[model samples]
Target: MTTKTSDSPLPWPPAAEQLPPHLRLMGIAAAKWVVQPVYVLAKLGAADHLAEEELSTAALADRLKVRCDPLRRCLRAAASVGIFRETEQDHWALTDTADHLRTDAQMSLRDFTVLLGEAPMWAPFGHIMDVMRQDTPAFDAVHGQPMYAHLAEDDELARTYHGAWSSLTEGVMRALTTAYDFSRFATIADLGGGDGTALRILLATHPQLRGILMDLSHSGEIHQGADRAFEERLRTVSGRLPDDVPPGADAYFLKNTLHCLSPDLVLQTLRRIRSEMTRPEQRLLIVEGVVQQGNGFDWSKLMDIEVMVNNGGREHSLEEWRTLLSQSGFRLTSAREVLHPQWLLEAEAA
Candidate 1:
């Protein structure tokens, strides 16, 4: 089946190849400190305050209850990166980029920013050397627990972590709904669908289709809104992957879930889904980024590093995808780019 192609614009911070060799390397080195200011701004909720009106640094600092001088410096650093703008002496306003940092923004990045800057997520990067030399994830080394397990113990952190994923998934779901045809499947199960974001988009897009959203027990509260909205057509199940797959759906989907798992786990998860397929016609759709084959810059390569550090998971190339699916008793039928770096791979029981 044919799907629409992406017209999305290229991401900012221009590609490394666009710059002179020396400057490119220098920019890469300087990038380490760039997120710090933005993180501080997000943590302070500066963008929310700025949304009402431009304010002097002193007033903004007072509202946020932080030291005026350091807050101003942080604002200046963020302004330098186009996140905010200094309108006049000591007065700052939100730039278009910074507006997305507001909590009420339709596409908010505030939680995602805070998540990346938080100690549990950021401190692990320092142990990347350990991840490389010893095979232990930097996150495990730093926190002595897996990322999800740590989140389980901290309710506030869990909210931020899941909220950040929900924010990130919203746009991806929009892209996916338009890029692939789901009308063919009368029912679809979103395995490990966090917060039911994808199912919300899919069911909204194709009115004829019903959906099952299966995630961990902790996601029950998160699914309440979706449950209320589409009460009749939607089913919410508390379950984990590589098992607990409910059967009898026309198709099953795993979006942004496999990459968070180890290879064996991924295989087991796929096999579990395969076992639940009662019909030969039942399909499986995997939505994730495929590592490109080139020396060129690709975002998936960068995400691969994050996955490695955080959970010992990984991004896969097309070859790797084929092998995994084959081992799990499915045949890859089509793989198309729905968004830059993200692909929609359709497979059927083999």
Candidate 2:
């Protein structure tokens, strides 16, 4: 996550680089079709089976429990987009992007891709028009239950859901820890921190920092090894947000939690946290994809639509975040874009 930033100047898009409106429109429509093969490859563990070597389609098919003909087609489709490389006529190997799809690979997106490909998750997008009309979550309309509730009832589904989220937390934490200093605080509380991945990273990085991981419950859901490693300092507390949070922590970390709530709920949650603060020095650090305002396309814009459709959540702009914090009796003191599409919004008692 400690990537280099370009200081050299670069020219803007030249006139020759611009495409015709029709071709651009076609490219946009084709994106949906392109993601299918990538998702299929990740779900089937095809990249993992490749073993970092160019394997014939038949061999890969045997490993994946699929027919050779269709399996070859799938690998070829992914190769076309540079996910995998076709070394020979029927032999394929993982590319740099496809390498990350391997099950055991570091920073793997395989689980996240599988979760996204699940029927319940993507089916809601089909009724996107209706979701926009109703102004309610499409997932709830399609499944007759909220997303988290549906996951909780099924153990396997819940693991997959949490795994997908944890996979993302690793990268985000790396970037954040590098960009900001958490050593100033002796105790840090992670509200709704799924699996305690972020807190584990923080505690490991800052040895002096004691931690608290609070969520709906601390059943078999959290990583036991992480707890045992820092058992003396890291406490797993079960509680709901807004209505409850551990008081007296020097700082409260709410990474990717606020964007899951509506405006009113967010305000209520922040106000509740504000009441818990015993000192003006206590901080609230919210890490999320703060929507950037512009006419051009960006990832947060797309994420905003997805969050709205799936969870009735909206990714807020910086101004909106400031307003929300102000309304909750906290002042937005600092805003830093530690990573692209993700910003660290810091607030203190107003």
RMSD of each: 5.3, 4.5
Query: Backbone collision count in every prediction?
Result: 0, 0
| lDDT tens digits, residue span 146-229, model 1 | 887788788888888877878778888898887788878899999888778888888888989998989887876665655455
Candidate 2 wrongly placed segments (more than 4 Å): 1-19, 218-220
Give the distance in Å from residue 301's predicted Cα in candidate 1 to where it truly belongs. 0.8
Cα displacement (Å) at residue 187, model 2: 1.4
Q: Candidate 1 has what TM-score?
A: 0.91
Q: Check candidate 1 and list the clashing pairs.
A: none
